[model samples]
Target chain A: MNCQDLQRLVHAYLDYELDLMTSLDLEAHLNECSACRARHAEMRALRDLEARQLRFHAAPAPLKARIARNMRAACGNDDARRWRAWRAATAVSVLALAALLAWVVLPRTLPGPHQVVAQSQEKMVYHIANSEDVATALRNVANLLEISPDARIVVVANNQGVDFLLRGARDRDGTPYEPAVSRLKVRGVDFRVCNNTLARRRIDSSQVIPEAKLVPSGIAEISRLQTREGYAYMKL
Target chain B: MMPHVDAAYNLAWWLVRNRADAEDAVQEAFLRAYKFFGSFRGDDGRAWLLAIVRNACYALRGQAPGAGVNEEFDEQVHLPGMVAEGSNGPFCRNPEDIAIQHADRELVNRAIEELPVVFREVLVMREIEELSYKEIARIVDVPLGTVMSRLARGRRLLHEAIVARMKKESPK
Candidate 1:
């Protein structure tokens, strides 16, 4: 009923956190006391003001993709997900403990360092989806090599674009893209294919061009590389 | 129903204060949650998921490159240190007129970043995420009273910080 007692319960009252009896008492005190009434109003106003000012920000696209990818892996196969997670973690940490953890966790047939891509700052990933854009992406790759010869480029193929990585697969004009892919590989470009796409389409990995590598998740890999690994993303 | 990843990611983001660390924490949390989904019997998926997220954030305590990294939260120690914001006073200044012009989303975010991790977590969960007190208490593993006090103190500190920032930016 007093000011001190009111202060103790004012916020609770404004937040509707008080019990029925306490709420009634607080209302009675506020009705009798103008100061308590004003305090109640300001508390509510301040709460609303702060709520309006401090907004909730949604997760960015890449982070969501990364999360969904990891979640899907978890829901799919426990052991496989754990192994793939270690592989992804290996991409992040180069510390001794990290290396030790990887060594302890990895199977004897763990993928070699040549297949391991730790994307440094100067690296980029280009995605090509349409047959029509194969030449355009190749041209872009050629232009990129000319502009930044030291750039470590990764060309990830998924969906219909996986054809470009197939052995003897030709461009829209019927000229084989293999020659360009081979030349780019010699120049240090990596061509990664989506295993999910290949499996869904019943294409065997052995049938893929020998130079190209197979990745478990294409969109997820692209998202993780761009978001976490700082790879520049270009869609052709 | 599973909680939305955005909810988990936002909580981690508020705690870690960066996209990379937040993503890592969220990713870890989701994996842990998925693996333990069979053990979860409660209907409050958001709170359960957030507890996992909070655990993941704690795992990144020394590693996260953000404000207040050294201030590991000790409830017994900090319970007395928080300045109690008494809400019993005559309303003199109009709440409308006390606008901090520079209190954009970023400034508000920075203000929140400056708060101690304990208070910051509760405040974000209650205010921005709009979780009930019971839900917050469950997520934080604290009592209802604890959640209320931290929330009140957090608002006071944040309000003060925003006003101070505005004053500092004003022409001298």
Candidate 2:
């Protein structure tokens, strides 16, 4: 092939998209051509520069935690349901019955919510998965407090949701959301985050915003709030 | 959630162009992928996961300025004035030249952010993610020729933008 033909095919060759015959033809042309060879060299160098220089942000801690925790919880539930179905299809052995009875009689996995102060009439648990979720939860909290200032509302942020409680966290436009968090805090709304998610994400305890408290697990906390605290649950 | 989280994150980051939105997009995509995991039939799990991410990114309300749910790739509108590959001048940042001067990723990132949405994605798939052209074509749902043209044009614009930024940062 000629220099002009080789020029168009250089990218294809570099990308390994060229067919065998075309690659051989380009190699033959490269042996005799100076300018085409120089272009080829430059393309390789640029590709190298790109590989070394480009930066990528990892799947940050909270999101990673959210996925892992949600997946595990979802899978655990699905597996239990599936196992029960399988067992029902077959004969229910005495050993299976004993195991089922043991689970039913055991104490709850999460700690019971304490009646720390005067109990409010309305109790609600807000689940926040993203910063925007936090926004929705906060708006709901403010609206709820407007109607019932003495209402007991708890916002539980876990997984990627902990980002809302991160210090100096910014919205998509780089606007800080800290003042809004402070406003919610002053109104007696409680904010709790999942420590398991935080630990797995490798975020230090200090990274958490001042207004939020850490819980052992998000899923467990949500369960505790719903079952033990008599709180209505809303996930944003 | 899959072995492809890194690849998935990279694709979303390139498309959404920010940490918070990209994280949201990836989280939503993984949930969708997990929900539809049984329906997956391809061996290219990374590409499949990325297709979900691309969809999730578009579904977000006000993702980036140009990203939309139904992204139509029209080559005729996008293929004008591609720089000649053999030409080497100010528009092209030669590796030898780039090495001599300091190069910051933020400048390169800004140049990428400014491209037409489709061109930016194609370039990102090919150059950053190192996906094959066929894989990119599958993910973007365009023909092979469209992929080639966009990639070439995207690379052309990216190189020009990088060189332009370098010149502005440290004038010769």
Candidate 3:
């Protein structure tokens, strides 16, 4: 609590940040030190002079308005609610335009279902509803195309194709297609059942082929694959 | 909150040294504080705002072509406040007293402004703003020891500048 110590502590003392004992000790040092006391007095005087001279007049009303305008210009408009609504409307319009173009161009882009069986190179995919002999129909198509028994074929069935890919609750003749289909999957020929058809026919997903992925809207999915993915589609 | 605002304005005024510029800086600091409020979790809020003000000032410096770019400054001559409307007696009592007060304030301001930006900022925050050593360190993004040392150096420089100006003004 000497001269140098008191000088250093002036800032801390003015701030009233020191604890009681430290404050008392500093006060004791100040009482005995005249030079330090004068230094402290000068510092306080300087601080007071600064505070008085540095008076801040509030920004004039016009200046505040100009600054607020400048801030908004620099940072972009802060109107979240208006921007959000505008964004939503723009998105909806874009989607609607896309759907309209797809509808207008779809028919011209695709070959007929019967033409698909004849012109396909590798194999043709057939999505059958409910037919009495879907397997026979598929075998005929495969033979006509001179496809081997092991050629890659995808059968997407609702009630009809589901039973063909899986079981029909009763086996077709003495031949059960599920075991043959499972063995075909092992050989890489894909078989899938339509979940949409299964739902319509009141059949559960488990009743279809276990390996089959349930396409939600089977007809739209079939068209999508043909138009979008270059897959040829055929009718049995 | 009021004290912190006062402290920040004092520091800003000392740095920019114009009421208009200081007011703009403080307003910008408040807006920035609101925008980045989420990021400040465990810090002295006042120090954090001052740090943001420091950055804002720098941003304004770069954006505006010549603001804060030049340390050398010339005081603007003031317009005569009152003049006799018609061909009357004198040019309204000379206005020398008012002019002197304005000149003294401007001299002090210019002295502060003449310091390098870093030295001026540290001095203003520590002395005029009355921030703690730790708060100054945080605001300036420097070490505590550095803040203490800089505060001492900055004060010395300011005192020297004021004394030199006073001596120049007085008769030799």
Return the DockQ of model 2: 0.12
DockQ ranking, best first: 1, 2, 3
My TM-score estimates for the predictions, one after another, are 0.51, 0.52, 0.41
Model 2, clash count?
Answer: 4
lDDT of 3 by residue, A70-123 (tens): 544544656433322222222212122322333344575553322232232334
Model 3 regions lying over 4 Å from their true place: A55-63, A67-236, B1-13, B16-37, B42-46, B59-104, B126-134, B143-146
Q: Write the per-residue lDDT of candidate 1 for residues B28-77, one digit (tens) a residue.
A: 88778767766666645556778898889988775332234222352223
DockQ of every candidate structure: 0.16, 0.12, 0.03
lDDT of 2 by residue, A39-146 (tens): 677666556566667665556767767776766566676554443233222111211232233234434562222121112355667788876576556655765564
Model 1 gets an lDDT of 0.66
Worst 10 residues of 3 chain B by lDDT: B73-82
**How much of the true contact map at the interface does candidate 1 reproduce, as a fraction?**
0.25
Interface RMSD of 2: 13.9
Chain B TM-scores per candidate, in order, are 0.76, 0.75, 0.65
Best by TM-score: 2
